[model samples]
Target: MTAEVQSVDIASPIDVISEPVILTYFETLNAGDFQATADLFAESGVLRPPFDEELVGREAIAQYLAAEAKGMKFQPLMATYGVLETGDTEFTITGKVQTALFGVNVAWNFVLNPDSQILSVQIKLLAGLEELLNLKPGQDKKKE
Candidate 1:
């Protein structure tokens, strides 16, 4: 059997997103624990997912995450994605994503600052998602 689908808060993956972190934020988003994700963000950090406005700061991130939690369910898939240490204070990560809320598959290349805390998050959804996914601009299916 596949991993049982469950309702997970998108922010729930924060704790597990360690250095060279591999996370499934979108996949884990449920009804609770979003604040946990926001907390992992640097104070002036931002999360940009294509079309939507950039969500900056812990407060704004919390609001965005909370809204996501209320609107959809998550099932962040586990894959052996890798990370690139592009800079002394930066890391780039790539991985798969799926959520009942999104109805599609996605990926993200998160750029974390040297502090090992999230600074900016960029998102992408694989091509097949255009038919069903409702993510932001760059992450939209047609582009991916």
Candidate 2:
């Protein structure tokens, strides 16, 4: 009689996801703290879009943050857009993240890792971001 080995996969996509993951750079990113944003990545993390250049490791993220930080005017407006888990190690976040880049709003789709670190961030710079600096997606800051 021969013995065979079997493989098992008990972890579903949700197993690796850290839902309600902490993102502590919202206000800092708006404040042009690129270094701060860069610090949020894991030491070996990667940030890339579907058709964009891949940013790998901490230094790369720091460089990218430096450029973005240089273009800041004031605090950015951001919120929790949506969360989707594709696999055990893959997660997606679609949020209304705004900045003064091109004086427009930036709706970002931030693909992240299990540790709440950034893997990718795609921004849809809105047409009139300057006009809505005080708004946070569903809420209007002007009403205050």
Candidate 3:
């Protein structure tokens, strides 16, 4: 299966993502420090990944990322922040995730606690149904 290259307007200036913890999370993740990334979250924080079971707590998030996100890098393009109805702070970020296998657009919605720790991060893939269906296992590797 072949992946399509979509045109993204990267010429526009990226909006500032003001949360220090969010910034640190991405930095640690890109640096392959999964434990440090997980530490930025609350003790009972939740990580809801696309098409996977929700992982709750720092330990679970750390383990899951260590196994799944080894060579992944996140390039954040833009962000928006607001308050949820439940009084929690919500921050949404749009970015492209680059892996050893492929690159995909994604959105991460974060709910933060009063202490500014991440309470939950819900990840969603920004792809159409056809694009998603076209993805195949080991597609990025050459057949020996």
Candidate 4:
């Protein structure tokens, strides 16, 4: 007998994301199209992931995501928009990221240039130190 695979449908948070470029970033990243995700950024865009050195430029961003973000899904829940003193468009999205082994809440702060291309994305984990320390490498958790 063959085992049937089941697919879970997670609601798209595109409506909550007001910025077009930011919407595309989540869409492409969730689709596991690393290169496409990277292409949303400007030529000198930066990705600042938690606990790591910033990945600078599209090539580095694509390569890093390809290596680390496979099987990861981002579910954005809320967004706050603003403008920096430098006049760049900025926004922060709070969401949960589901990985094969576990899920964690995260906030992504995006900075966009005048042309709507990504200037930088800074990701911060919302988990407490105790919560983060409790996660086991191979433990599977139900998607919340």
Error of 4 at 126 (Å): 0.3
RMSD of 1: 10.3
Error of 1 at 46 (Å): 0.7
State each candidate's clash count. Answer: 11, 2, 0, 0
- Candidate 1 per-residue lDDT, tens place, 34-118, comes to 7767767789988887558999998998888777546554444332223344542333333344444335445555556556677
Task: Please write out the lDDT profile of model 2 over residues 16-54, one tens digit for every residue.
Answer: 223333244454555677677777767776655333587
Per-prediction TM-score: 0.57, 0.49, 0.81, 0.85
Candidate 2 error regions (>4 Å): 1-23, 48-52, 71-102, 127-144
Write out the backbone clash pairs for model 4.
none
Computed on alpha carbons, the lDDT of every model, listed in order, comes to 0.54, 0.49, 0.82, 0.86
Which stretches of model 4 miss by more than 4 angstroms? 1-12, 137-144
| Candidate topping TM-score | 4
Q: Candidate 3, clashing residue pairs?
A: none
Candidate 3: how many backbone clashes? Answer: 0
Error of 3 at 103 (Å): 0.8
Best by lDDT: 4
**Candidate 3 residues 23-129, lDDT tens each?**
88888988999999999889999999998899999999999999998989888887777776666788778888877766788999888887989999999999988
Give the candidates in order of lDDT, highest first.
4, 3, 1, 2
